[model samples]
Target chain A: MNSLFFYISEAVIGMKRSIVMMLISVITITISLFIFGVFLLISLNLNNIANSINSNLEIKVFLKETVTKTERSKFKQAILKLDHVKKVNYTSKNIAWKKFVKEYPHLNLDNLFENSPLPNSFTIGLDNNQYILNVVSNLKTFKSWVEKVSYGGIIAERMQKFSYYIKILGLILVIILTIATLFIVVNTIRLTIINRQNEINIMQLVGATNNFIKGPFIIEGILIGILGSLGAVIFLKIAYTFLIIKCNKILPYIPIVQNKLEINIILVSVILLGIILGILGALLSLSKALKRYSFNKVK
Target chain B: MIKLKNISKYYQSNSLILNNINLTINKGEFVYLVGPSGAGKSTILNLLLKIEEPTSGELFIDGVSLLRLKDSKIPYLRRNIGVIFQDFKLLPKRTVFENIAFALRFYNYSRSRIRRQVYQVLDLVGLTTKLDCYPTELSGGEQQRICIARAIVNNPQILLADEPTGSLDPETSWEIMTLLSKINMRDTTVIVATHNRGIVDDIRKRVISINKGAIARDEEQGSYNS
Candidate 1:
């Protein structure tokens, strides 16, 4: 306990001695973490939007005009039993025609045709978007009852491809940003170690053990990390909240992850990332410094 | 007790810092190592502190062989041996009290114990009045006294002083020598390496003179010269 206090005091003294350098390190860390937070927010929102669109996608199965009500009900029951099938709503030809006319008001259907051109169709909701291809293929196998099965095949394929690309791009960006942040942090810590060369020499000459000397330095590094993380979290919170308000005002239709739970998750992850990066930077620099100047050889 | 047998230190294939040095010093003895500049005086001190490994030889302090000692054990060995340099090597930012306290902190001493021990050493070195003064604020003699206080604060069994009074006036040099004698009286072996002929003559301690990296003369109650 006494040693811990001593280590902390020593670290504080070291920090005080190089206040400007320490501040620069902290600020650099803050900026890097903030950038990382921004990237995370963007990726999260893109994911949310993709998921919303996927959930709304529904498959339309058109039946033959001669199909009876009993056959249509049986078809609906079979679709409900299929994997990933959530809900099935049967639509009669009359109802389909009414919905079609309501969707396209310019077409005067009464003058164009006496009978409805639309066929009976069943609207199929799915538990998961990944099963869209499988369900579509399975519906095609029901050739006796289904006249046509369409789930916007081209659009669905394109959306899935786009979602995959977004994930890959987000991953690549995160890795690149994290590495850049680590490099900056390592360089900052190396500078701090260089500045304290004299102090470290004195400590070794006084017969301090390796751990005794390294404890304060490691603690100093951890403190820097925690402070940088705290700064990033505060900055990110304010910036994110402001961004949410501004985005809502400008683009009301854009879907974003604005819930408190999701924002908190992002905040926690950024703080954690900051801390890990800080520690790694400190360890790398400290080890390099230690190698350059062996504590066992004081002269 | 300290013993060195056939110690040889080489910087390169051709250059030797210390060559085939054999010596011993028992407990509670005051000894002076006298030699000219670059005559391996500092190298010997370095060897005692294990700051540099010998090209070849065995060194034993208090019956433990240092040749095979692990690097991790060096600090503990150093705690048993105090070292004083000509420059005083005091942390300029630390006060006299803190400078002395620095040695004890390595041993996991409680704050109260460290405070007590630091004050005790400060009083011994007659610097209790200047406990809070930084090294920059102290005179050369006072700074050297604080260095001595730091060296002895841990109650080390052996104290090695390498030209400790080299930077002081003759009077201040005498004062530092007298303090070292006082420390020696406490059953701590004292070894002072110096080029000062006057103090070496006046002290009349065991003097080992070295020339060309080897001991040239060893005398009892010897003067600076043969």
Candidate 2:
């Protein structure tokens, strides 16, 4: 006879025995994990925004459509010769049109142009991005061949710093929320133990082992934790997918996490953490209660 | 059989609960422990139950030295014994049937077997009609009967009743005593601790009287004062 099924059934019975308490526990975990996940999503998107802005910070020297290949090579070499210049990437007119089409497949450039009129451009990479303004100033000497010399302004740098602070602050808040979740879980389990103290004494009096006594409470913790995490995961999934679709329509260039697999992986990690903490909380509260409670009285 | 040899229990290292004691009760015996309040009648039961350690002695249950028993084996030890309390410790929320079925859980009995055994015990206690009644709904006598049904449902070899009739009237107490006597006739050893002099004298069983922390008298077929 497998006792596992029996014990698990006992845990289920216990859950139904006091549905209100169980609901309180589940709701607590759900709200906590949901808040934690919201912070996580915000931090991830902030990092994405910072990267997008940094990519735009590089100086772009758009060439006049009439420039020869030999002139392009000379211009690239001259740009590389500048202080703090790391490398130069050259994009042809046709390649730029293809890139634009890939980024916005819905927007047909053909409707706006008779042909691929996109200009060939050179992107300058610098060893230190703080020298972007200086490089942009140097490109002025070649105004005859250059259509435009543009780089992201001071706002890009500010956004990078802002996202960095958000990342650090998000980390601290996540740690605090995790601790709070554990404490709340532990307290909830402790309260359950107190409520069932009479039942526990009866169990002991009738020859139930310590493990048998602990089985249901541990199972309760796991169920509560899992439910909480799953609730948060489901909510995040629906809300995030909707937010991503809306953001894509309103702010098309903003890169938010829209990958289904990535989101599932994150949710799975959250559930695993919830389970581990649930078991820990159960064990901690149970040990204290069991030690305090002898056969019929609390010591 | 149960035995206590040179058993001494103390509290906080100085306040003695039970002084050097030696006692033994054979199988198929009905023994009464009678004394005044705080005479340590309950402490002896506590020691035998292993709820508290005998501070300085050897205690044995069914020929096994309880001192040498591993902590893990205590539950198994308890399985061989049943305890009935005065206050009728039944879960207020549970029906009489559920209360009896709870004791059979350690056996991992199937649902049919559990229901069958619970019915059998309830029949023996004569409360088969009140199976669905909760403790709160049952009369005091009926509640104690439910507790008895729960205790004996497992068919333990030894039964320990600590002031089992303390909360009952004389008639109900006699009725409970008659039921315990019926259980004892079926090869179960029954040890009852009580301060009720009327029940002790009328029952005419082996009586051990304690005063302060030591046994003051031990007699067979003893009345309350003999």
Best by TM-score: 2
Across A1-299, the per-residue lDDT of candidate 1 in tens digits comes to: 88889878877887787777778777877877787777777767766765666566789999988788788778888999999999999887888888777755544555575777888888998878778899999999999998998875466456557666766776776688678777867776677677777666666666677778788777777777788878989998898879878877676556668788988888888777777887787788787787576634433
True contacts kept of each: 0.46, 0.57
lDDT of 2 by residue, B18-91 (tens): 89989999999999998888888898887777778888889988779988888788889888889999998899
Over the true interface, candidate 1 deviates by an RMSD, in Å, of 2.5
Q: Candidate 1 lDDT, tens digit per residue, B1-226?
A: 8999999999866787888999999999999999998899888888877787899999998888988888888888888888888988888877888888888886777788899999999899998999888899999999999999989998999999989989999999999999999999999999999988999999889999998899999999999989
Candidate 2 global lDDT: 0.84
Best-fitting candidate, scored by DockQ = 2
Residue pairs that clash (backbone atoms under 3 angstroms), model 1: none
Residue A117 in candidate 2, Cα distance off native in Å: 7.5
Give the alpha-carbon lDDT of every model.
0.83, 0.84
DockQ of 2: 0.47
- TM-score, chain B only, every model? 0.98, 0.98
Give lDDT tens digits, candidate 2, residues A122-206: 9888899877778888997898899998877666667777777877886787678778887877887887788788888878888
